[model samples]
Target: MHPYDTIVSRDVDAFPLGEFLDYPRLMSVDWREEEPRMLSAFFTATGLPADGTTLEMDDRTSYYQLVRGSDRVDVPWGDEVSAQHSMLVALQRVFGASHSIRYLNHGCADTASFVVETNEDWRRLESANPHVRWFFTPIERLPDVFKSDIDELVRVGETYGGA
Candidate 1:
Protein backbone atom coordinates (compact mmCIF):
# COMPACT_ATOMS: atom_id res chain seq x y z
CA MET A 1 0.00 0.00 0.00
CA HIS A 2 1.15 3.55 -0.69
CA PRO A 3 1.59 6.24 1.94
CA TYR A 4 -1.53 7.94 0.66
CA ASP A 5 -3.43 4.69 0.91
CA THR A 6 -4.39 5.85 4.40
CA ILE A 7 -4.09 9.03 6.44
CA VAL A 8 -1.55 7.25 8.65
CA SER A 9 1.94 6.11 7.75
CA ARG A 10 2.96 2.46 7.60
CA ASP A 11 6.40 0.95 8.33
CA VAL A 12 6.69 -0.22 4.74
CA ASP A 13 8.50 1.17 1.72
CA ALA A 14 5.31 2.03 -0.08
CA PHE A 15 6.26 5.71 -0.59
CA PRO A 16 9.57 6.84 -2.02
CA LEU A 17 10.60 10.50 -2.18
CA GLY A 18 13.91 10.02 -3.98
CA GLU A 19 13.97 13.55 -5.40
CA PHE A 20 13.41 14.91 -1.90
CA LEU A 21 16.46 13.12 -0.45
CA ASP A 22 18.64 16.25 -0.48
CA TYR A 23 16.02 18.79 0.56
CA PRO A 24 16.41 18.29 4.30
CA ARG A 25 13.08 19.87 5.27
CA LEU A 26 12.27 23.22 3.73
CA MET A 27 12.98 22.27 0.13
CA SER A 28 11.69 18.72 0.31
CA VAL A 29 8.11 19.83 0.80
CA ASP A 30 6.08 20.27 -2.35
CA TRP A 31 4.01 22.98 -0.70
CA ARG A 32 2.22 23.50 -3.99
CA GLU A 33 0.51 20.21 -3.17
CA GLU A 34 0.38 20.68 0.61
CA GLU A 35 -1.58 23.13 2.71
CA PRO A 36 0.67 25.45 4.72
CA ARG A 37 -2.06 25.97 7.29
CA MET A 38 -1.20 22.45 8.33
CA LEU A 39 1.95 23.87 9.91
CA SER A 40 -0.03 24.95 12.97
CA ALA A 41 -1.50 21.49 13.11
CA PHE A 42 2.03 20.12 12.90
CA PHE A 43 3.20 22.30 15.76
CA THR A 44 0.28 21.21 17.88
CA ALA A 45 0.86 17.61 16.89
CA THR A 46 4.57 17.63 17.75
CA GLY A 47 4.03 19.53 20.98
CA LEU A 48 6.23 22.43 19.93
CA PRO A 49 5.97 26.21 20.26
CA ALA A 50 4.62 28.46 17.50
CA ASP A 51 5.66 31.84 18.92
CA GLY A 52 5.39 34.35 21.76
CA THR A 53 2.79 36.36 19.86
CA THR A 54 0.66 33.27 19.75
CA LEU A 55 0.72 33.44 23.53
CA GLU A 56 -1.04 36.80 23.51
CA MET A 57 -4.17 35.58 21.80
CA ASP A 58 -7.24 35.86 24.04
CA ASP A 59 -8.48 32.46 22.97
CA ARG A 60 -5.51 30.73 21.42
CA THR A 61 -7.21 27.36 21.57
CA SER A 62 -10.11 28.55 19.48
CA TYR A 63 -7.75 30.44 17.21
CA TYR A 64 -5.78 27.29 16.48
CA GLN A 65 -9.02 25.45 15.84
CA LEU A 66 -9.81 28.00 13.16
CA VAL A 67 -6.32 27.76 11.72
CA ARG A 68 -6.54 23.99 11.49
CA GLY A 69 -9.87 24.14 9.72
CA SER A 70 -8.49 25.93 6.68
CA ASP A 71 -5.41 25.58 4.50
CA ARG A 72 -5.30 29.20 3.29
CA VAL A 73 -4.64 30.79 6.67
CA ASP A 74 -1.07 31.99 7.16
CA VAL A 75 0.95 31.11 10.25
CA PRO A 76 4.28 32.58 11.15
CA TRP A 77 6.62 30.09 12.77
CA GLY A 78 8.49 32.30 15.26
CA ASP A 79 10.70 29.39 16.22
CA GLU A 80 12.18 28.63 12.86
CA VAL A 81 14.12 25.62 14.08
CA SER A 82 11.14 23.86 15.54
CA ALA A 83 8.81 24.84 12.72
CA GLN A 84 11.09 23.51 10.00
CA HIS A 85 11.65 20.36 11.96
CA SER A 86 7.91 19.87 12.40
CA MET A 87 7.34 20.22 8.69
CA LEU A 88 10.10 17.76 7.86
CA VAL A 89 8.71 15.30 10.34
CA ALA A 90 5.28 15.66 8.80
CA LEU A 91 6.72 14.68 5.44
CA GLN A 92 8.55 11.65 6.78
CA ARG A 93 5.33 10.52 8.40
CA VAL A 94 3.75 10.78 4.99
CA PHE A 95 6.63 8.78 3.58
CA GLY A 96 8.53 6.30 5.73
CA ALA A 97 11.78 5.88 7.76
CA SER A 98 13.79 3.29 5.83
CA HIS A 99 14.57 5.99 3.31
CA SER A 100 17.04 7.41 5.80
CA ILE A 101 20.45 7.07 4.23
CA ARG A 102 23.70 5.70 5.74
CA TYR A 103 24.64 8.85 7.64
CA LEU A 104 23.67 12.51 8.01
CA ASN A 105 20.20 11.37 7.10
CA HIS A 106 16.84 11.16 8.82
CA GLY A 107 16.36 8.50 11.51
CA CYS A 108 18.44 6.32 13.87
CA ALA A 109 20.69 5.42 10.98
CA ASP A 110 23.55 7.19 12.78
CA THR A 111 24.67 8.63 16.07
CA ALA A 112 23.99 12.07 14.71
CA SER A 113 20.26 11.48 14.98
CA PHE A 114 18.38 13.39 17.68
CA VAL A 115 15.45 12.62 19.88
CA VAL A 116 11.82 13.76 19.84
CA GLU A 117 10.47 15.11 23.09
CA THR A 118 7.12 15.85 24.74
CA ASN A 119 6.65 18.29 27.56
CA GLU A 120 4.20 20.67 29.26
CA ASP A 121 3.59 22.58 26.04
CA TRP A 122 1.82 19.46 24.84
CA ARG A 123 -1.07 20.45 27.06
CA ARG A 124 -1.47 23.81 25.41
CA LEU A 125 -1.20 22.37 21.90
CA GLU A 126 -3.42 19.47 22.86
CA SER A 127 -6.05 21.91 24.09
CA ALA A 128 -5.71 23.71 20.82
CA ASN A 129 -5.97 20.46 18.90
CA PRO A 130 -5.75 16.94 20.14
CA HIS A 131 -3.05 14.91 18.38
CA VAL A 132 -5.24 11.84 17.97
CA ARG A 133 -8.23 13.71 16.55
CA TRP A 134 -6.25 16.43 14.83
CA PHE A 135 -3.61 16.66 12.01
CA PHE A 136 -4.55 16.51 8.34
CA THR A 137 -4.65 13.38 6.21
CA PRO A 138 -1.45 11.34 5.75
CA ILE A 139 -0.53 12.15 9.36
CA GLU A 140 -1.75 9.87 12.09
CA ARG A 141 0.53 10.82 14.99
CA LEU A 142 2.94 13.44 16.31
CA PRO A 143 6.43 13.56 14.82
CA ASP A 144 8.12 10.68 16.57
CA VAL A 145 11.27 8.52 16.80
CA PHE A 146 9.18 5.49 15.90
CA LYS A 147 9.65 6.63 12.33
CA SER A 148 12.73 8.76 13.07
CA ASP A 149 10.48 11.77 12.43
CA ILE A 150 12.19 13.80 15.15
CA ASP A 151 15.63 12.46 14.32
CA GLU A 152 15.28 13.52 10.71
CA LEU A 153 14.55 17.09 11.78
CA VAL A 154 17.63 17.25 14.01
CA ARG A 155 19.89 15.74 11.35
CA VAL A 156 18.79 18.36 8.85
CA GLY A 157 18.94 21.10 11.46
CA GLU A 158 22.62 20.59 12.31
CA THR A 159 23.91 18.53 9.41
CA TYR A 160 24.04 21.67 7.33
CA GLY A 161 26.78 22.74 9.77
CA GLY A 162 25.54 26.37 9.85
CA ALA A 163 23.74 26.13 6.53
Candidate 2:
Protein backbone atom coordinates (compact mmCIF):
# COMPACT_ATOMS: atom_id res chain seq x y z
CA MET A 1 0.00 0.00 0.00
CA HIS A 2 1.08 3.55 -0.64
CA PRO A 3 0.51 6.65 1.40
CA TYR A 4 -2.40 8.61 0.01
CA ASP A 5 -1.65 11.89 -1.71
CA THR A 6 -5.32 12.74 -1.99
CA ILE A 7 -8.24 12.42 0.38
CA VAL A 8 -11.77 12.25 -0.96
CA SER A 9 -15.03 12.11 0.93
CA ARG A 10 -17.40 9.31 -0.06
CA ASP A 11 -20.23 11.80 -0.15
CA VAL A 12 -20.07 13.71 -3.39
CA ASP A 13 -21.78 16.80 -2.05
CA ALA A 14 -19.92 16.97 1.26
CA PHE A 15 -17.87 19.79 -0.13
CA PRO A 16 -17.66 21.82 -3.27
CA LEU A 17 -16.12 19.43 -5.78
CA GLY A 18 -14.88 22.23 -7.98
CA GLU A 19 -12.60 23.47 -5.17
CA PHE A 20 -10.32 20.52 -5.81
CA LEU A 21 -9.58 21.77 -9.30
CA ASP A 22 -8.05 24.85 -7.73
CA TYR A 23 -5.60 23.03 -5.49
CA PRO A 24 -2.13 24.35 -6.23
CA ARG A 25 -0.29 21.02 -6.40
CA LEU A 26 -3.02 19.08 -8.20
CA MET A 27 -1.79 17.37 -11.36
CA SER A 28 -3.93 15.18 -13.58
CA VAL A 29 -3.02 13.01 -16.56
CA ASP A 30 -5.72 11.88 -18.93
CA TRP A 31 -5.38 9.34 -21.69
CA ARG A 32 -7.79 10.75 -24.21
CA GLU A 33 -7.95 12.59 -27.48
CA GLU A 34 -9.34 16.09 -27.10
CA GLU A 35 -8.79 19.55 -28.57
CA PRO A 36 -6.37 21.96 -26.90
CA ARG A 37 -8.95 24.73 -26.99
CA MET A 38 -11.45 22.55 -25.19
CA LEU A 39 -8.94 21.75 -22.50
CA SER A 40 -8.08 25.39 -22.05
CA ALA A 41 -11.71 26.32 -21.80
CA PHE A 42 -12.34 23.61 -19.24
CA PHE A 43 -9.47 24.77 -17.07
CA THR A 44 -10.55 28.36 -17.36
CA ALA A 45 -14.06 27.52 -16.27
CA THR A 46 -12.63 25.75 -13.23
CA GLY A 47 -10.98 28.99 -12.02
CA LEU A 48 -7.57 28.23 -13.43
CA PRO A 49 -6.06 30.94 -15.54
CA ALA A 50 -5.50 30.29 -19.26
CA ASP A 51 -1.76 30.75 -18.87
CA GLY A 52 0.64 28.41 -20.68
CA THR A 53 1.71 26.87 -17.35
CA THR A 54 -1.68 25.29 -16.60
CA LEU A 55 -1.67 22.43 -19.10
CA GLU A 56 0.74 19.90 -20.55
CA MET A 57 0.37 17.17 -23.13
CA ASP A 58 2.56 14.28 -24.18
CA ASP A 59 2.34 11.47 -26.69
CA ARG A 60 0.80 9.12 -24.18
CA THR A 61 -1.59 11.32 -22.21
CA SER A 62 -2.90 14.83 -21.66
CA TYR A 63 -2.67 16.35 -18.19
CA TYR A 64 -3.33 19.50 -16.23
CA GLN A 65 -0.98 20.80 -13.56
CA LEU A 66 -1.88 23.46 -11.04
CA VAL A 67 1.28 25.28 -10.09
CA ARG A 68 1.69 27.83 -7.37
CA GLY A 69 4.45 29.30 -5.27
CA SER A 70 5.69 26.88 -2.61
CA ASP A 71 5.68 29.62 -0.03
CA ARG A 72 1.92 29.71 0.04
CA VAL A 73 1.14 26.32 1.57
CA ASP A 74 2.61 23.73 3.92
CA VAL A 75 1.52 20.11 3.51
CA PRO A 76 2.62 17.26 5.71
CA TRP A 77 3.47 14.14 3.72
CA GLY A 78 6.21 12.38 5.70
CA ASP A 79 4.75 11.92 9.17
CA GLU A 80 1.38 10.27 9.76
CA VAL A 81 0.48 12.37 12.78
CA SER A 82 1.39 15.54 10.95
CA ALA A 83 -0.50 14.46 7.89
CA GLN A 84 -3.60 13.65 9.93
CA HIS A 85 -3.39 16.97 11.67
CA SER A 86 -2.99 18.76 8.38
CA MET A 87 -6.02 16.98 6.99
CA LEU A 88 -8.08 17.83 10.05
CA VAL A 89 -7.22 21.48 9.66
CA ALA A 90 -8.03 21.39 5.97
CA LEU A 91 -11.38 19.71 6.54
CA GLN A 92 -12.29 22.26 9.15
CA ARG A 93 -11.41 25.05 6.79
CA VAL A 94 -13.46 23.57 3.99
CA PHE A 95 -16.50 22.11 5.69
CA GLY A 96 -16.47 23.47 9.23
CA ALA A 97 -18.41 21.48 11.87
CA SER A 98 -21.61 21.08 9.95
CA HIS A 99 -20.78 17.87 8.10
CA SER A 100 -19.35 14.50 8.99
CA ILE A 101 -16.05 14.47 7.11
CA ARG A 102 -15.18 11.07 5.76
CA TYR A 103 -12.03 10.99 3.67
CA LEU A 104 -9.90 8.35 1.94
CA ASN A 105 -6.19 8.53 1.49
CA HIS A 106 -5.05 6.99 -1.82
CA GLY A 107 -1.85 5.44 -0.55
CA CYS A 108 0.80 4.18 -2.91
CA ALA A 109 2.85 0.96 -3.04
CA ASP A 110 4.93 1.48 0.10
CA THR A 111 2.21 3.07 2.19
CA ALA A 112 -1.23 1.91 3.20
CA SER A 113 -4.34 3.70 2.07
CA PHE A 114 -6.76 4.42 4.88
CA VAL A 115 -10.08 6.07 5.59
CA VAL A 116 -10.67 8.50 8.40
CA GLU A 117 -14.15 9.19 9.73
CA THR A 118 -14.20 12.65 11.20
CA ASN A 119 -17.11 13.39 13.42
CA GLU A 120 -17.18 15.48 16.59
CA ASP A 121 -14.99 13.14 18.64
CA TRP A 122 -12.57 12.18 15.89
CA ARG A 123 -9.29 14.04 16.05
CA ARG A 124 -10.19 15.30 19.50
CA LEU A 125 -11.89 18.28 17.96
CA GLU A 126 -14.45 18.60 20.75
CA SER A 127 -14.51 17.19 24.24
CA ALA A 128 -18.16 16.35 23.93
CA ASN A 129 -17.56 14.42 20.72
CA PRO A 130 -16.90 10.69 20.46
CA HIS A 131 -13.83 8.81 19.25
CA VAL A 132 -12.58 8.89 15.67
CA ARG A 133 -13.07 5.89 13.36
CA TRP A 134 -10.03 4.76 11.37
CA PHE A 135 -10.18 2.07 8.69
CA PHE A 136 -7.27 0.36 7.02
CA THR A 137 -5.99 -3.05 5.95
CA PRO A 138 -5.31 -5.77 8.52
CA ILE A 139 -2.76 -5.04 11.21
CA GLU A 140 -0.36 -7.66 9.83
CA ARG A 141 0.07 -5.65 6.68
CA LEU A 142 1.10 -2.51 8.52
CA PRO A 143 4.62 -1.53 9.45
CA ASP A 144 5.84 -2.40 12.95
CA VAL A 145 5.69 1.18 14.11
CA PHE A 146 2.14 1.51 12.89
CA LYS A 147 0.95 -1.81 14.28
CA SER A 148 0.41 -0.62 17.83
CA ASP A 149 -1.34 2.47 16.61
CA ILE A 150 -3.66 0.43 14.46
CA ASP A 151 -4.31 -1.97 17.30
CA GLU A 152 -5.24 0.84 19.60
CA LEU A 153 -7.51 2.30 16.94
CA VAL A 154 -9.16 -1.07 16.54
CA ARG A 155 -9.62 -1.42 20.26
CA VAL A 156 -11.27 1.95 20.37
CA GLY A 157 -13.48 1.22 17.39
CA GLU A 158 -14.65 -2.13 18.70
CA THR A 159 -17.24 -0.37 20.80
CA TYR A 160 -18.49 1.95 18.07
CA GLY A 161 -17.89 0.39 14.65
CA GLY A 162 -14.60 2.20 14.13
CA ALA A 163 -12.49 -0.48 12.51
Highest-TM-score candidate: 2
lDDT, candidate 2, 122-151, per-residue tens: 445323222212222222223322222544
Error of 1 at 133 (Å): 36
State the TM-score for model 2. Answer: 0.25
Badly placed stretches (over 4 Å) of model 2 are 1-80, 103-148
> Backbone clashes in each candidate structure, one number apiece?
0, 9
User: Candidate 1 residues 18-120, lDDT tens each?
Assistant: 3223322212222232325444443444444554212122254322211221222222233232333334443334323322111222222322222122323
Cα deviation of 27 in candidate 2 (Å)? 16
- TM per candidate comes to 0.19, 0.25
**Cα deviation of 72 in candidate 2 (Å)?**
13
Q: What are the runs in model 1 whose C-alpha is more than 4 Å off?
A: 1-77, 97-163
Per-model CA lDDT versus the true structure = 0.30, 0.31
Model 2 worst lDDT run, 10 consecutive residues? 103-112
User: Number of the top candidate by lDDT?
Assistant: 2
What's every prediction's RMSD, in angstroms?
15.0, 14.1
